[model samples]
Target chain A: MTADTTRRQLLAGGAALGWFCINGSWLQSTPAQAQADGFAPQHLSVAQCSAMNVIADALVPGAHVAGIAAYIDSQLSAKNDSLLLVKYLGVPTTAQSGFYRPALDSCIRLLAADGMTPQLALTAMGEDAVSDWQGPPASFFSFVLRADALDVVYGTEQGFARLDIPYRAHITPKKPW
Target chain B: MSNALSTDTVIVGAGAAGLLLAARLAESGRRVTVLEAGPKRSTDDLISSQIWARRLKWSGPQVEELGDHKVGHAFNAGFGTGGSALHHYGVWLRLHPGDFRVASDHGVGLDWPIDYQTLQPHYDKIQSEVGLSGDADAEIWRPEGAAYPMPPMPLFAQARILQKGFEKTGRRTAPLPLAINSQPYQGRAACQFDGWCDAGCPIGALANPLVTHLPRAQKAGVQFEHNALVSRVLRDPNKAARIRGVEYFQGGERHTITAKDVIIAAFTVQSARILLSSAADTTPAPGNRFDQLGRYLTSHPAATVFGLFDEPTYPHQGVSGGQLLSHDDYDNKQQGNGFGSSQWLIAHAIKPHDLLGYGTGRPDIVGNQLEPWLQDAAQHLANMTLVVEDIAAPNNRVTLSDATDTHGIALARTEHNLDARTARLWQQRIDEGQEIMRAARAREVWHGPRVAMHIMGGTVMGKDEQQSVTDSFGRVHDTDNLYVSGPSLFPSSGAVNPTFTLSAIASRQAEHLITQQ
Candidate 1:
């Protein structure tokens, strides 16, 4: 696919694919496709992405398959054009990744030290009970991460259909992002 | 740098106010150019999905916000061609008569330089031009004005259910005054009641700038430059009181647009940010003689009341701004343990997700309980919002931040804390809202946390030079041919939405500017 596609062409592809930098090549892919192909993140490290996927998926059951981590990674890398929920929380474009990196690492630390299940760690994080928890308040981070998870899982036409709501489109979004 | 572009008038931001001003000025045989900070977009870009609606919000320089309220600048401000109005819910309401005399009547907040009578004509004009759907006679609290251009939007099941609660509580409800087409008006399609209004009304039913002033501006030959982030108004060094257009950055390159008159209509925060940044070494910013350029910032303290009913309400069947309005306590500012006016916007069409959604508000519900709860709420939920008036406090202001953007221009930092009375009033009204929900016979009723909605003030208009940044006409106090428009000129936030009021002010300003031309 071309690097830039018109709205018609994108919609013609039935749910457009965002241009992502995987490995060294730029390819058109969705977050789900990116996660399945093990697409390398340009901004976040592999370990960080793995850790985030675990917590985010735990927060929303289908988030892992829906590519919550990849969605966040892609949005963070998009800089000023990011569609992350954190933007609505007043997180600056330059400091968006700064919010996610330490928070995800804390989840990694919680799993390593306490050997707690993803569900348990999520409960602890939501309550701000995790010891040595880092990055934006733990509870706040959980809310934001869960919001990100929700977006990927239930913020699209298919997501709306899952709840049996009408996906009435005046102008449908070419890409989920 | 290319040679400076020249125009009779240069308006910053292509939002509602800017487009209205551009169209009015350009049609009167003047060259008007508008500079927008974000990407170019049209009705085709207004996707039905809420996720895509994020693109309509502010994407310019980072505005660091502080204090209890913090203005929620990131969420409230907008980007791109149509600006924030593209994503706004079409809840257009006029300010109450008491709103103009905040200082005289209540001894709190600044008074508007002009009274409702001065703006009454403009309000009537804009309403007639754009067509507002409402029952004028039903809104008994509405001040003397012409009837709405179109009939009110239909009350869906959700709205009818919510109205019963208000009626049971002895509060009267009327169809909401919205700048949306009830039927085809002026060649625009009527609202589809699809609940995608927050995602920009693509069908031209909602009076977004695209279907309103923008088309007029385009037809009148107004030039628009997208991705042009204006830094500050360029004041002529030789004549300190006169402006020489504006300086903006486009595609990493600084450019100048010299205009006969310069209008800063970049919403609330950025409008103040531009003027605050325009301070000269010898002279302070044009209207900052008394350090009042960015003062008196205010936002309505609002919250949503959610309830789950036994009957299917078809929660996703109406506009996002709700279907009905109640101002039963609007005239009595000091009634019911509250100091300011409060109104109810009842029965907003809803979704299962998004920031303002019921599911998102219930962060505690998770695991297997989520999907079932969402499905249940989607079919049976009803919601209404309580909007309380905001008193303009001097301390709550927008100033230049320590931070700078890529072009070395100082970013905006807003500190907005709700007045004690306003906060109390919000709590009182929200509590009342909960009771109304239950009175309507809902099994359970809950309310969301107090939030900042529809930003206003910042560069407020007043008669006194030392007390205000601009005159009643929105011209900066000490500057010639330099003005500020939009919600930034509002001196007080009435317990109603600001779009109708701001658009009226723009019309008034446009007429004044055209007369000067």
Candidate 2:
């Protein structure tokens, strides 16, 4: 077989369970037992990630456990056309980037300015960002962080469960609804 | 490339319709050449997961918009030969008979010149060729069509639970007819019933364009040139009309393909943008004098409702998005409601990776609290999405933006407004759905933040050339030798997915283009 064919086979095998469920090709697992394999990260600093995890769990409970963080991180690492190309270079490509870092720093700066702890200021900024779409809300920092986080935390898999959401998957049987 | 390699037909957008048309044309011994904006992808090059399928994502330069919602432009189009069909869930449903002639019945929304019966034969033919899996006998509510080639997929626990709830609520649900293979026909393998199809099915079981039609087209001596981003249709000064080929950007350089007949199969927004932008380049005065080119853009208002079941729903065990469909109210389009009709696509297989991306009522879950919910919800991931019908409105349109790209091409600007009538319909159906969930004994019920589903209807087809971009058979009304296809031809957005119908219409167009000549 060609290298591409071999690679395709490997991915197909690895994602066999997903393929079966998505395409109706084979029965990968029963509805009950298949929950354990939800994507998760292996190398995350569990302690550092704990705060984000806790917030995510409460927002969409089952999704956090389903490895949404891992998934988010994975998606984040991949480059796309939408990526603010300069962000990865650790340089300011857009004016928003210049404002973003300072806003985060200001959260700490405000605490320092007011004689409050740096950690406490960070927590405060996080809280303010989540509750309202107003204020500087960490200026541009809030937009990037919240947008990226929402892309993961409140996305297709985890978001649905958190809201107890469902889709109308069928149209013919005329079920109870 | 040699100029001598010109063909009788040059098709833009090597997507499902274009590929299928090319294959059929080549089989008839006609020279067919396809130009795709994205990279070429063969069956072997197809990846198994959404994460690995990054190349399929559209890489169009940034666009500017005035609304709270942009088209999510860059991410919408697929950047490969198979186009969006590569990542599509393969949900195939025909437009209801009532969908056409809406202006007569409802006194609003543009009416389609050709009725559902006209498209029915083509739908049946495409379904057979593509091998649709469903029980036509079971779909009594479905429009007239031939039987599905394969049997209905087995119901998983999530669908079963939703069915029970829907049944309890006195709602009607049917098995979702999907392009996904159930038992495998047309020499393709049967589906393994895993839920990772949004990532592009690696196995040939799911009918992605790469696996099904493009290969056949290639085998028929159809030439496919990828990464050829057509900038515009260049025309000559001759008053008669000059079909002088398409100008595109390829490999950091500009290239042109001279052809006799050109078909623009780019998806809705892009297709209209191409014409509008090209008109600006070639014919500055074209104005919306046709009064139709970029008007009446519509998309299904897609919303999701999630219910937590007590039992293990195992949402990840079945087809990506096929099982039960709620059509009890599909044909119930009231004139003033703005909302036409709606359908339910249930038990959508949700992978842990991409599920949370759809911001619904779901709050973010993080840290310690998430694990238990995952453990509990994984077994009971019974989710359903509501696809509401949106009528073509002049206000909801795809317009040209002032923002020019690096190549100096004008970007597409879109403006979408939801009428109060449509909003009321959405609220009513969602409320009803919540009641159904309660009847199903769901522990909780939540709805998705209403967002645009499938983008369509910008460049529409109609009988009157003055009011529509293309004719009934998708032939451009202005240009004699130019044709356009895809969901852009939809005069009115139906309650169901448009892929199946798009394929059917494309088939009809291809046949018309070949035979009429």
Candidate 3:
């Protein structure tokens, strides 16, 4: 068969599972479960993860447990196939890391300088009042990250049950992320 | 390109129009080949999760946008086998008779080459083929057409409660016409009211291309090449008047497919992008001699109104398109401050999260304040969307961006802006929608920011080359065997979902092609 045929087959045959690298092996797990299991992210540094978790958990409670860092990391690794809503907003997959890495540094800077809480920094970011903030407008980045947090925390079947709505899925998703 | 491919006809894009045309032409004994930019997909791939549904949206190229109103190409365009119709809410509405002559009557926008009467038979034929469900008589504003084949989908608690607002406001409500099967028909099962339409109905109930034309094309021996990103339509070197096939990138290699006929059905932006990229040094692109290839682009200016009533509305109990519709203000485009047609899709099935979710609309409720508010809105929220017609303008267009893809072809850049009249109409409808929500005894009411709904025009059809890129039959004016299909050929932006009208146009094109062949 042709190489193009093989590539098409690979893409079409993707398993409906989010495989995380945990304890030196690949395991199918939700973003939250991957976080709880100490899965190593293929992308994102430890500092970036810490900053993302703090900021996301502050935006939507339980986002840290839901693994917003792991979710964003996994999506970024997928390149053009990334399911992040930022794709709809005109951010190219190749430039996605450029968007996250720098804004995350801004958050790190704010947290380190004033001993400010994550909530305070997030409010400032939302208001576009962060001093010396960099990369994608602070408010826009907050909107995107907040959407990412909501996806991992309440965009799944289990999340629906928490809100007292029936998860009447015609084809239930295999992964939560 | 050593191993060149050849076919009697080469169809670009495996979306609704291409698949329908493929099945019809292949059945007429033509050797047809379809190239899809996205991966191969089946019903099993349609997972019922809002986050998972994002996989169905455009992932091929980044479309840079600029304007007061930008068409949400990535959100509205689709990928994979079934295309955007897979994620569509199945609101299959027909254009009104008055919608055909906006330029001739209102002195704004471009009028369609053909009137609604010429297209009505095809609309009826597509409905019969796809099995639509609606109460035709109840739709007081409906244009002339055949009655739906199946009875309307049943109303739920949310729809019943929302109808009272229309009653009190002296407005009218009708069963929303849908392409979904309300009862078992044509071997497809009935809808189960699972609220998973946008996630794609996997049970063959909703008339997605998967259940409609894809299988028929497969049965008719139409060969499909997945993950083939087409760059441009090639010109026939020996004969300048005739058109050749296409060049595409697949499997990290460039390939060429030569055919007697070529059709571009790559939705709106990409269709215009391909034509713009086809311009070789001296010979302007096919159908672009007058620089009218991507002009007159349009999108419906739409927004959603949400309210939390005291009683349980059970907002998540029906199909995503909503259970009822209001077209009381549809016939009058110049009503109040607005100068365009508008309609309301009422009582849609909703969830607690995702972009259109009520909880997400209220970004102020966060941290500990979120879950409780989400839980309350999940059961008690009532919502509806206002879709206003946009007047097509020459300035709104799709052009080639300076940025190039891996294949070195310029990417698409679109700029679409609303006319002052359309914006005013949208605001008027939004305010009226809020009033109706309050009239329904909603304790709290709010509306989402105005957003772009359906994308259309770009490579619109008209009488001649100076007016548009194609004729009424979608044939490129300068070429003998070049054509375009889908909503890209629309000359006006009617205030309704476009899938049904696009399918009808496809049906007409298929018949014309077959009879001519």
Candidate 4:
């Protein structure tokens, strides 16, 4: 085999988990188990993962099934090789987790407060209405979460197919980016 | 001579400009060596994934950015062999005559040391050599030059839909001049239109340095040392006016490579950084005699307007750089609330995710409403980008950061703030862009955030030594052999993609250098 083919194979092998998620096995795990042990997050705590899932689901439903937290965790784990949308916004790869961690913690804390619904929480974030919003602007955090949710939901070949968009490939990616 | 490490010309950065210079100089029998900070890259490395493409972007030392609008260095610059041009959308365009003399005519921004007439021949030569595709006659607002070497790529349905908006608004549009091939040319294949231009076109369709200049340079025996991060330009201790060579890090070891001439074409920020870092205890940096090394830094303020048409627009059918161009407002630099030029690049082939992606644009869209909206918009969405010129201000500059990289070289820091006039122009164009989309029979229309596109003018070229880092030929005013190239030499940020203009400038510099040699 050629070196190019071998390289592609290695890359594809390395990205098998992402491919599995893209192929819809991401929905197999229940939310509780997924947050618990189905896929252990390297960067986020279980509570933080749960919070991310909740917030991401509110931003883009099916995000839990689409494995938004797992996707984000996987990206965060990759560090400089991350595919997270926040990378494009001038956030250094080294500081990406820092950008996410406290924001998710703050979100979790806000959601746990008395009588706070997901929709209301999201609305408050959109309006920047959170009084004690911590770690990056709440509006900015919401925007990032929404973008991340979109990635898991609609940034794949199957995802494109669902949208009726042709997944035309000059060189079809063996795995989702 | 063979045993010695020194070369005739040593270029820091194996980017478009550097590679072009290397190939030309090497072909003329001058030994050329290029030092690239990033890893070696071939076309095989360009995987068709945006996530993988991140590897192509600037992953070197983090640039500390400050200002209302940061230069977006991380997004705009590139790493490895081909540099930022590796992931560039191939929208090759010429600067208008007015673009060359912004200060002389409008009493704003710095004027280029050379006029359009001086660079026209070089543009013509580069266009012929590189092979651009467009209908030059149809480009009503184009400055005079030779016709495009190839016919324009066929417009997709999305472009046709957007063209209606231009017609209705009494504005005109022509096919966008692209460095990508319409048909096979010079053995390179035509573009596949997969809308993955930002991923670094692997098919050799886009005229990146890998496909265009790098190979030629290699064939001409131009030596390239990858992962060689240049720290500073070294000067002869006795002769302060002469540049001796450069100090660089390769394989975790510091090395010095001497040359007769040194060319710093390391994109905008790093180029300026290297010069700023070269400051010694006895003398200032090579081109910082007047503290003008990194002044007048500029990035075009750009925004995208998206519209969901009633008809099946099929937005994914063209290249990422878009299919059509409208320069109707480009010539009129001072218009309405703005003091600079603006143009519309219509019908870009978009993706579902990433920053400019259709999915990312609609943050308000999500939940159950997301799928149907995406599906419909995938087929019917038409989008166009408005590129507004930025005025070159002395306050907008690149400086050396206090923070040092692993190699102990001070990291580059950039500060770029848009002039109120430029911001006003961007807002006005965005408003007009939405109106055009509405006129095109769109049911829904929206615009994206105003962001920096192409970067330019950190080491600006001008006639006056006191006001600029380089002279008309891109030679540092104080240093005899040290020079700068690339978009960083621009005195004014024109409302056009800079690759064509920068390549032409490099070509002009090449001729001047060869003649002088």
Alpha-carbon DockQ of candidate 3: 0.57
Q: Give the per-residue lDDT digits (tens) of candidate 3, residues A1-177.
A: 243442233223223357889899999876666777788888888788889889888888777776788789898899877888787777867779888989998888878875698878878988999889989999888888888887776787656766778998888776664
lDDT of 3 by residue, B1-517 (tens): 5588999999999988999999999999999999999999999988898888888998887888999998988889999898888899999999998889988888888899999999999999999998899999999999999899999999998888889998999999999999889999899999999898988889989999999999899999999999999999999988766888899999989999999889999999999998899999999988889989999999999999999988999999999999899998887877766699999999999877777877778877778788778888988999999999989899999999999988899999999888998888888889999999999989999999899998999889999679799988888889898989999999998899999888888888888888888
User: Stretches of candidate 3 above 4 Å error?
Assistant: A1-17, A22-29
Residue lDDT tens for model 2, B1-517: 3343467788889777888888887887788888888777766555443334445656554444444333444444666778888877889999899899888898778999899889989998999899888888777688888888889888988888889888888777888998988886778888877776766776777788988888788899998888777778766557425566777887777777777788888887778887787774435422245667888888777777888888888776787776888788888798354457888898887754332232313434433445455556667767788888876778778877887766788877888776677778877888887888878889978776776677678778888876677789887776767788898899998888888888999999878877965
Tens-digit per-residue lDDT, B379-487, candidate 1: 8999998988888889999989887988999999989987777777787788888999999888888888888998998899999998998999999989889999999
Give a tens-digit lDDT track for model 4, residues B65-139.
899888899899999999999999989999999998998899998999899999999999998887899999999
Pairs with steric clashes in candidate 4: none
Considering only chain B, report the TM-score of model 1. 0.99
Assess candidate 3 and give its lDDT: 0.88
Clashing pairs in 3: none
lDDT of 1 by residue, A1-177 (tens): 121332223233346487666677888887776676688887888888888888877777667667677788888888987887778888977789899999988888988865689888878888899899889988899888888877877787766766778978888787788
Q: Which pairs of residues collide in candidate 1?
A: none
True contacts kept of each: 0.64, 0.08, 0.76, 0.62
TM per model? 0.96, 0.80, 0.96, 0.94
* Residue B314, model 1, lDDT: 87
The CA lDDT at B151 in model 4 is 97
